[model samples]
Target: MSVRSLPSPADDPSTDIPPPPEYDGNLPFAAAGPEPARTGGERLYVAMTGAIVAGPFLALGVGGWLLWGRLIHPADLLLALGLYTITGLGVTVGFHRGLTHGSYTARRSVRIALAVAGSMSFQGDVIGWVAIHRRHHAFTDRPGDPHSPYRYGTHLRGQLRGLVHSHVGWLFRNERTPADRYAPDLLADRDIRAVSRAFPALCLLTLALPFGVGWAIGGTWTYALTALLWAGLVRIALLHHVTWSVNSLCHLIGERPFRTHRHDRATNLWPLALLSFGESWHNLHHADPTSARHGVDHGQIDPSAAVIRLLERLGWVRDVRWPTPDRIDARRA
Candidate 1:
């Protein structure tokens, strides 16, 4: 070309100059991205707790007028006791020890059975239960512990309030331990994750199953309705209190025979032993989290341990972490 070409923007040396700083596209004091949205799950959890608590109070008012008065039926009492035992053991043995703690393995069939039975208790999905429990162990009586009774203080009034706080009030709170942090293993398990997601359906079945059984047994609508009240609602309420007591009463008022950190006030309350499937041996549990047998001493009467033994005998479970004499002695205070 005869004419000299003007310097294009890209070819020009001055074009390399940095652009002027502009506030149009960015904030002067901006930090990173916005925080995550709070889940509405806590509202649902609070509603659930309220319903469970209110159910018992209402039942007591009505049932006292009906059952405890001249209309009492022994079958109702028996049904309550029987259902409580069945579902209580399902939570303690099947959910806590077997699923959450992995104290012992189970056959595929036993695993499925325990999952179903535990779901019938209406506590929660296996994964959520395990997640909260694992967090408790990871931060026993500390800031992150899900239901530490000592969160209030050491004074009598504070401790009393804390006891109630830990026992049942904590369930109404919105705070939740992260599933990824505490229960990644369970979260990764397809079966456990699925079961956890089916919690509402399982709870519905928990109520309905007792009603169906009562109908079959008594061949009457009244019997079925009464059974649902006693076995389903009352049983759930009672078990809820007993289990929550371990987190509250067991920690606050028992003999700490097994040495542990001062902050970890886990103790064995003998009165709750039989009813809790030997979980009242709390001192030994904190001392040795992996032990399949919590009631390690003679005459401790761990029904759960007995069941584990039977399962092991049948080759349904292996590699059980049973307590040894040395281990027990080492943990003695």
Candidate 2:
């Protein structure tokens, strides 16, 4: 969780801006660089990444067609909503807020359960997800940030390209963050390590659960298939884009009411607030990285904070870092 690796901001006279520190940069964002030839293993990696990204999208189209045919079942929508809430909270409340930032301390069992739930979100293993996120905070919008929309420089063409890069293109690149460096604490925890290793099993379980439930509820393979499409693939696609929008759109278009590090342009994009579980309250999050509550403003909807509060009431978590008014004022832009 240590972000001390972040370099101090430097001044660039031409743009009156600071440049990001150098790191293992992606070739696509490297100015005037040629794309490197991919080895077989690298090609396989990209292929798998492509399938993961494209499959959910394909399901979305299929689901829409099924919907237009008036063949979509009520059960399918219900299951999709249920799984979306569970897995989305797992990412926002568990992986991002709790583990990544130490916003609260959960009971050992609750902690492990949350990690398992988050792993089921198809977001990557718990440890790796936390590591990459921590690295993003450490270098946010700078050279080392894994998904910065400003990677290509701030011109019209670059902005458009960076948008695509930050949204999903970065996933196709070979930008591996060292978990040992950013997530050593989780690496040391036996329970978390166990959950991390169970990632693949959890992934299969995530899909199979919907399929089995759909069959049980509707007693037909067609029901199972539709459920798998809506609840499994389509749900994942929605969550993925919502999360990626926090990386891309949140930085590009919204109110920056809170101050962040130089070159960190995280913003509070309200349109994504509910879908992203209040994670689109990006400006405040960057300003106060460890706060348990992101939507501290009045009337701002933060379902993840509500979930955390319920957990606290249930004695599953404590030492919550609820933002105070004074603390909020101090970070105002």
Candidate 3:
């Protein structure tokens, strides 16, 4: 006996459900909200900038003249360089890699060390830095991005203006990224909360530590003062620009070899490779968000990755997601 096919949903018009509402594909532009009232931190950052400018000039004019009239010591320069390198790495490896990305898990002692060292950078508390960084990744190059070099219209002058805005002007602006939305995890952590609260004390120590070291090493107040000037103030200013470059210059320039869903203009600028501790490998980072290592390829010098590897070997960190050839191939543009 011949059998007939039962009616399908498409054949039965009455049984059909209405199609879901069509998205126009145009994302609604979020309105610029009322300017936020400045916080103590905001005022502090401004005051610090002013102090950095004036302090250096005054030191050069008065202190430098006095020291020059007497004699210049080599030990002072060594102390400055040493302190700058250590503290700068603390911000880069501790704040950027370990805290912000969770590239690898560290032991309690390591975690505390990283947190304390990062705090010494005076960039802000760990939570604040991570919050703003997460927001930067979330919005990137778009209107809501914290420091997109493309904020202004695409013109020679506009891009130049935008670059300057991205580099340092964005920090001076009163807008604050919502900590609850971007960094709830950090805010909830007791250790992080305590460390963040102790930021004022950390800032004082950051400046003082260099001076103390210089005095102990050279046995002179003049040497300690010079160390403080170079290591404390100048180092911070230099690192600030290096970190900011990843936001402004990395986006606007560099090669985009990997595909991305977001309007992320991040690139791997080799020039900033060593200084940024392999953070210049931005394209791969955006491609594989959770990967522990950014500098995946051979001949790419990633000091941070080396540090992580050493930590893993020492059993201080585990579950590192190093890049595989297959994964790299998959992300290839």
Candidate 4:
């Protein structure tokens, strides 16, 4: 029996292959992960989704301070920070690790809550989000990767162009990765499908939630509006930039402790450790997507992993893919 050696990460399958076809519905999880190497374009007709929201965010933040002498109340500050923690974990733990990679199995209720909380982050609908992310992994830094920062050549102008596109310009794109091809398991999950559909409603609810709490506490419209601006808009803006930085800065400049043979440009940015919910451990993530804990080393803080650990103790998550020493040693650059 001839055992096949794993392909060197430097030797990514670069040829364009057709994306996997849709199954006849209800494919099991193990069989549904994206296969290797598949694929298109540059454009300026992008929808600018993030920019549109940021305009309003900046306006509210500055205008409120100038006119009302208050940009955010103390309660508003707390509300934003608290919600940011929840929704950020929802993306890092729930969406990226649990749902997208099956890094762990969560209780049905916990899974559902994670999806709902992830929707509150306003990143994308569940199915679409999974599809785009899965496609990103399947292609990595190769041509077909949806968010590769090296889309343009590595020359100065090309790098600049590529950075912009990868960071947020991709948001303007009308092209979407087909869920059946990249995220078939999520598409097949009824809970995920429902959450994907409820994205718009969830957005409304998330934004309104802080306002409601503030109004109830203070019994004033001023407090309600202030909370809405800070917790709702400003918080979204902050998380957006942090999440986008993974696609942008993490790929460009950071410590590459885990060598991936240039298959992709993921790096671990220690500065982003806390802000990104431990997701700045990017090189490790691309090296082993199924590992539930990305910050594998001692002294590295991973609040999301801590959450998963707590849940595991409480029987809320199982089959966590904590990195073993052997696995870590094998992947060291």
Candidate 5:
């Protein structure tokens, strides 16, 4: 199936999902507060964020050394692929679509399981992640957005700087998205709270699991080390950039065919489609946030939607807000 093209005017989709709260374009574009002073707790937070952002990068050098010595193993590649698919889906399907937007109603067990899986991605606790994302939606590409590529401005120099800021720099900032204000539903869910609390432990396990499995399969510390590098560190890093690309590149680049709120410039970036589980069809997501499917047009592959469909078929989820042809057509530009 080919992707359908629409004309250059926009229409709103007819769905129950309300548009994100709109803000007038009067807020300051620059960061509003004095730089946060780093206290003991703040220091630790920055240190951990640094490690999460940089550790996988450092692993790339070590991986290259291993490859030079013929120490790379097929099991490591297989393990990395498996873990990447699982955790990536956990974020795209569970954290973003299900929890953050209520795209579908999952069974209690399924909901908790997806939350646990997503926490292992080392992104953040589920509640915090959802809260931050909700805030982004509420103020997309405008002043209050946590990571808009347009944060700096629309000029060339600012766009370049904003790209870096949106891609990863904003993670180190002290800006906080309050759960009570943005994600009260997740905050009130006992199962989700437990999963959020387990985030640190899950981060450790995400690394250690590959090591133990590698040793079991390959029978050596060398094997375990390689698995730790590729499956553990490299996989996390790859997913990090892919997810961030949705925030940065998805906004500044690609085709925008759907009507979103003023200043919401989300786009359909097909190059990132498979790796991001169809989330790169971000224009549609911003156009109709509660739709169970983002890649509503022909030939736009959306693995997360497929997973949600499977769960619905298995009775693990219901009330999926799948888009109809009319809804899709109405959203055309």
Candidate 6:
């Protein structure tokens, strides 16, 4: 005769319960291998993007040296800064927070403004941008993610490859996120659809507006050209890299103060906090995706949050998802 034995977790293979879908201490990034071979068009697009962005910058440097004092105009500098601020907020507040995450609800007017501003960033059309970003949240750093730096393995070579791929290489890939699946709300809205259709025209307007402003202020074609260079090309390039950094560098470098869904490697990149308009607090973002304020911790300085708060006060936006202490604490690692 023997005493009845108590059943244990290891007693039967079928009895093993899977961890919560959120996280179970599994490492997925390390396991993800290199992505598929990039096509010729993708490579060409990458090359052209590099050339267009870098070309103007090189010209600016060389021209600045040749015409140092002439190139350094107060009006040009201010114009660039102004466009950067307006357009950057449009993406952060309008595209990423409002449209993509529904972090806050905005009036139709506010929504249109944000959509237009985000388009000024020249990333993509509102519908497509929201779809891709929404898909990013849905898949994160997992295999299905469109731009995870860890698409390649976690080894040194793989990390480097992943970094480049995530930074700007993935843009060349022809695979687009399905707007129908990821952004049904945007698709249904007539205003959003109209904006999507006019993205190409808006891209031109963003540049033209700056040039016109410069021409009017300085009363010269030279000034208009310079503003086009600085405020249009250079500013777009800078903003592009900063936003892309949130995708690439934030995943690979910076602090992971909060734990996110399983295998998500988003980190709070402080150096980019200001430039990215508080988007660099990416770890907190992934941890609490619905929270409007990404830079939740003390002294985090989230300008986008501030803008949202202003909009809330002005009655332009409603249902702002400001983070609560309990919510923040729950996501802490």
Model 1 root mean square deviation, Cα atoms: 16.4
lDDT of 6: 0.80
Q: For each candidate, what TM-score against the reference?
A: 0.84, 0.91, 0.82, 0.84, 0.91, 0.85
Clashing pairs in 4: 47-172
Preferred candidate (lDDT higher): 1 or 5 = 5
Q: Give the per-residue lDDT of model 3 (tens digit) for 1-333.
A: 000121211223342333223311123223377767768987897788667444544555554565677644566567656665666667766776677666667777887788888888767888898778766766556666778777674577768888988887787774678888667777767788898999889989988987887788778887787777666666666566677788888887888888654456788888988888788888888777556788887777887788879889999977676878999989988
Better of 4 and 5 by lDDT: 5
lDDT of 6 at 42: 73
lDDT of 2 by residue, 68-88 (tens): 998789999999999999999
- Tens digits of per-residue lDDT for model 5, 1-333: 000111111222321234334433333375577876789999998898898899997888888888898888999999999999999999999998888888888888998889988898889999999889877887788877899887777777878888999999999885888888777777678889899998989999999999999999989998898899999998999999999999999998999889887778899999999999999999999898878899988899999999999999999999888999999889788
Query: Global lDDT for candidate 4?
Result: 0.76
Which pairs of residues clash in candidate 5, taking residues 3 or more apart in a chain or in different chains? 9-333
Mind giving the per-residue lDDT tens digits that candidate 6 earns over 289-316?
A: 7679999888998999999999999999
lDDT of predicted model 1: 0.73
User: Candidate 4 lDDT, tens digit per residue, 206-236?
Assistant: 8899889989978999889878878888788
What is the C-alpha local distance difference test score of each model? 0.73, 0.85, 0.71, 0.76, 0.85, 0.80
| Model 3 alpha-carbon miss at residue 96, Å | 2.0
Of candidates 4 and 2, the better by lDDT:
2
Q: Find the 10 residues in a row with the least total lDDT in model 2.
A: 3-12
Model 3 bad stretches (over 4 Å): 1-45, 48-72
Q: Which stretches of candidate 2 lie over 4 Å from their true place?
A: 1-36
Clashing pairs in 2: none
